[model samples]
Target chain A: MTRKWLRWMPAVAVPAVIAAAALAGSLPASAGDPLPAKTPAEVLALVAQHSAPSLSGTLEQTSRIGLPELPQAGPSSGSGGAASVLELLSGPHTTRVFLDGPSNVRVQVLDRFAERNAVRSGDQVWLYSSKDNTAMHLTLPADAGHTKDFGHYKHRDTGMHGVMPTPEELAGRLIAAADPTTEVAVHPEVNVAGRAAYNLVITPRTEGTLIGSVAVAVDGESGLPLSVELKARGQEEPAFKLAFTSLSLEAPDASLFAFSPPPGATVKEIEVPAHGTGHWGKGHWPKHGTESGVVPDAEDPAPVAPDAVPPDAVEPDAVAPDYRDPNGALARPTVTGTGWESVVEFPASPASAEADAMLSNDPLLQQAAVAVPGGRLFSTAVVNVLFTDDGRVFAGSVPAERLLTAAAAR
Target chain B: MPSREVPDREVPNRALPIREVAGTDGAADVGTAEPPSDRSSSGWPLLASELAVLFRRRRTWAMMLALAAVPVLMAIAVRASSAVPPGRGPAFLDRITQNGLFVGVTAMLVCVPLFLPLTVGVVAGDTIAGEAGLGTLRYLLVAPAGRVRLLLVKYAGAAGFCIVAPLVVALAGAGIGAALFPVGPVTLLSGDVITPEEAVVRLVLVAAYLTVSLLGLSAVGLFLSTLTDVPVGAMAATIVISVVSQVLGELPQLEWLHPWLFSHYWFGFADLLRQPIAWDAFGDNALLQAGYIAVFGALAYGRFVTKDILS
Candidate 1:
């Protein structure tokens, strides 16, 4: 029996030892290697270098925008409302983004069972949905120049046009917002998607800012950002995280840069109204006559009897200076806080009273919003919007009190 | 010495001549007997015969009936429910009220994860092992149906089940759905609406896609069936593996393993509802199922051919 057992010993022992060694070898050796430390400025410079002119990768974004649960819009509710905006910002979304130079970019957002692709190549941009087999082609204005700085163009275009912000565009905006007032530091090196990265932490120096700090992990070699995390003030955890779960610096296949509506898809062509001399274009204010257009300017306020106003109600314009044009061209929004805590204030129109009333009546909106002293405040995890009785709308990343102060200040 | 004495005792007149003739003619007899069996049994006839035997089983009809009942029950439940809030459930569940065909889609979605796979497992797992368990495998082999050809026939029978199972549910759901609810233009998940004719075409496509998706599981079951003589054990093992794959697919940390899991793209049919019909995931599913078929089909063939038919 002993001899028989010995005969099989080598067979068993050899494989066992080999497997043990293989398991040991697979363990990460990150502990032994000390990362080289660098200053914030150096890291920022590397990040600048990393933002390549053309690149593509898979992006994963998770927004814990602490949005209060809103009532579902019943079939009666019309399309393109504030509820949709909240829906866009309050979920975990995954997308594949490809950028070729500044003029050609494609973003494909994946749904559970569907896909929405926005492809911008040259002067034409196509929005395609696989679910409905519908395609919308938007021809950019001739003057929307083909600049190499696509990030800047995308920000200016998408922000004004109300297009959903792509993760790559959002990352660019966050990085561009960095200024001297931001306290920057380098964190220990970490691995992102199997690649070594250097974390650049940016903390706002100002008070009343809701964001604690923003951390961006830059690929050590490519200088490209691998991930960006935002933590709200007083919170130990990040409220929002956008990261490239997988990235490739390689230029994507050329065919992806083109878009042709597949057969059977309903194709609609959109003519982007030319920009007016005023800073505000058709993109900012609702284009009248357009299908599903924004609520027509409230020049004629909804039939709310003047008696509806209480004697104690404070006039918002009296407290806050009117910064908007009577013709409805909005003054460029003013930014107060820097970096992650920045508050962008757009002077609201008194004409918007009609629009406000319509929104206030929306059961879904009413449920999502909380009554404030002078207005209604809609709060989400990462953003807060204050709609004042005087028709001024103040939105920021800060808390409601911060927005209230901004709204009340002269 | 006893063997020699026995031959000598029987050696009388015929022993020497018979022994000399047997030695010379043995090779010729063997050659003549082999060709007739080889030439007579063609693969198609054998396949037809095997399919007949398989379909004649009461269990096959029972499985088909059970699958058919799923859609009927789903339609009844959805019709009875007061309201299904939009965007609350799987893609088409909310639309069941508007279009009865959506009930079929909802039924498919509900069954694909567990019921469909389990039914497939039962059929596929019984293919080879069940025959062996009943002590019929040896007799079949003796009929000299080529081993590889016999394995292929078994696989084809299981593949046939995979196709028919989904069709049964779809037809039942469509029938019950038409009776219980409204039928009109189908609204796709992409928010695009298509004509009823287009919707029917899509439903057919969905059924076909589902059948292809099930190919992976069928192959896995067939492979497991080749490994064991006990049909129940093979069925249980196949179901367990599918459940394990599904659980692993759900784990975020094991996301890297998702693409390799046979169940990973089972839901890719959802893409077919999109306006342009997103084909990336759909194509990937087809290719992945084909890969699984190739690998496990080969494995089943490799093992079954050399297996001892003790039963």
Candidate 2:
């Protein structure tokens, strides 16, 4: 009797699990929802009606990972300060747009490196390479025609794979697959971002993989994606969740899309790798603009508002006073031990072997490596003081150029 | 006589055939009294009992004692230091303990590419080799114990060492690290700081994951030990394999190749320290390591059970 029951146990468990999964995937749709009959184009058209050209906000992001019991990170909230956060609210296939805002009509495309990030504000799209100090700015063409077909994964045969599918694209595809035959529940609810949103869940019409259904919460008013949760065909728990924070719908200047190189700045055309083409996506930007144009000053060359503060509002008229002069926290150099003595100051550079040696030895100096990048590259220089008692023990970057300059001046 | 599990394909035709023996001492008169031969003559269970005897060695005790002392010493070092910049923090000492654990794990990691899987390789590397070097392998093999039992015994002893050594080192290191380093608030990669209790739990989890990761290497070592005569060669080979894999695992160009290598998951435990825990990478790492353990373990069992014990 026990042996017979054990054989039937597995058979009973499989069908029971299947039924439960089927029920879980097909949550009843609520009333007064009109999205059930819309195709991708029609769905996008509905989105375009209420959507604005641009959205901007302040973003404080904290990304972490690990098990729930022992998580990867603690909460770290850093202030983004007065900087404007921009995201162009668009459907998955809407890759490039000619947006007119704080600066007037230029081109904006979802940034591929930043995982299909929407471009919200600012005229010039500036990106700097950390490895090399090279910078690039992109501009929209005057015609603003859809010259390049973007966001078509199926059109790869025509040598056009613009970028990986956006989160909204995935959500749209899931919804479209389940439209007429199956009803998806759409609910208005608050998401992690503390904003009201329409939560949409799609259940496929046919038999499929474990994740036969998908759910996403889109900001109802902004048309921006706030969060997404996915359920597999068999599982009760969500397989994964992605959340976007600090959403807004403010308009941006149109001119922010136009890119003009500074005079004497070298302009080189580089080909960017297409997404989902192969491993390691391409990085080179399409080169069309020439460097002959006078580089606009870092200051806002074309101010949108009359009250718009100049970009370089914090610049001093003359060289700042040296605080090390008696009144400074470091008044006089106290002679501790007998050796080589002098206050030395130099900017941090990887090329400087001496600075590496000094910084590597002092634990406090390590943070300097990461800090230099967050600020203007040329703004602050590293001030180094060397007190060498045993010359043989520690020979600081022996051929000091600044020391040579001082010696030559004397 | 012994029941063998070696696949028929790998069994050499030139290998010696086993003869039936009536009693425990039946093979003694024929000079097949070596521990491994005796094990084959006796049985697998008897071999396991012999492994317990091998663990009773003074040298094994001393080695374990020394390894167990490292964390305590590390803890003392951390406690004695005046100001531990991030450089001097518990993480650094934790790294030091990691280095020591890696030495043992590397022994195992080295075996995956060439030798048997890691755990088998570690035991196999030292098994006959260590015994042969000590001139006890021949004696043990020739004793009432059969060759198979001797092999099993040695493997069991090594596995016991491998599991115990890492835990002791981790516990000692963490204990010392906690005592020596400032234990107030632990800063994490996510810019969130954790209290001492939370940090302790995370560290313990990290150590436990590391132990699981090392199991594959240990299995490989035991398997390799069966193939070689000198245990040092097996030991050296194991370490070399680990070093090479570690080097290969770091190349950015071959980032895709990383998921396949055993060492790829070595630092995965550190992910636990991150806030919210990045499980995508960690889960992938855990799955990969578990697969390695299963494959290496099966290979070791098949090889040891079937291979000719000429040594």
The candidate that achieves the highest DockQ relative to the unseen native structure: 1
Candidate 2 per-residue C-alpha lDDT over A215-277 given as tens digits, one digit per residue, 9 for 90 to 100: 666665556555555544455654444444444455543333333432223344333323223
Count backbone clashes in candidate 1: 10
For each candidate, the alpha-carbon lDDT, in order, equals 0.64, 0.38
TM-score for each prediction?
0.58, 0.39
DockQ of each: 0.10, 0.01
Q: Top TM-score: which candidate number?
A: 1
* Tens digit per residue, CA lDDT, model 2, B1-311: 32232122343333321212123542432224223334334445445554555567575566556665655654455445543332122233322322222222222222223322233344446766676566444445434455445555565566665556555555555555544443455544323345656766765666556555655566566656555667878877776766677678766456567767777766555456444343434666666655554555445544544444444
User: A199-292, model 1: which lDDT tens digit per residue?
Assistant: 8887777665566777888877777778878777777767777788666677776767667765445677665657512222223322212232
Q: Which stretches of candidate 1 lie over 4 Å from their true place?
A: A1-37, A51-53, A68-84, A146-148, A155-168, A234-237, A273-347, A350-359, A406-410, B1-118, B121-265, B269-311
Ten-residue region with minimum lDDT total, candidate 2 chain A: A81-90
Error of 1 at B159 (Å): 8.0
TM-score of chain A considered alone, across all candidate predictions:
0.71, 0.35
Clashing pairs in 1: A50-A223, A65-A381, A66-A381, A130-B274, A130-B275, A131-B274, A131-B275, A132-B275, A133-B275, A133-B276
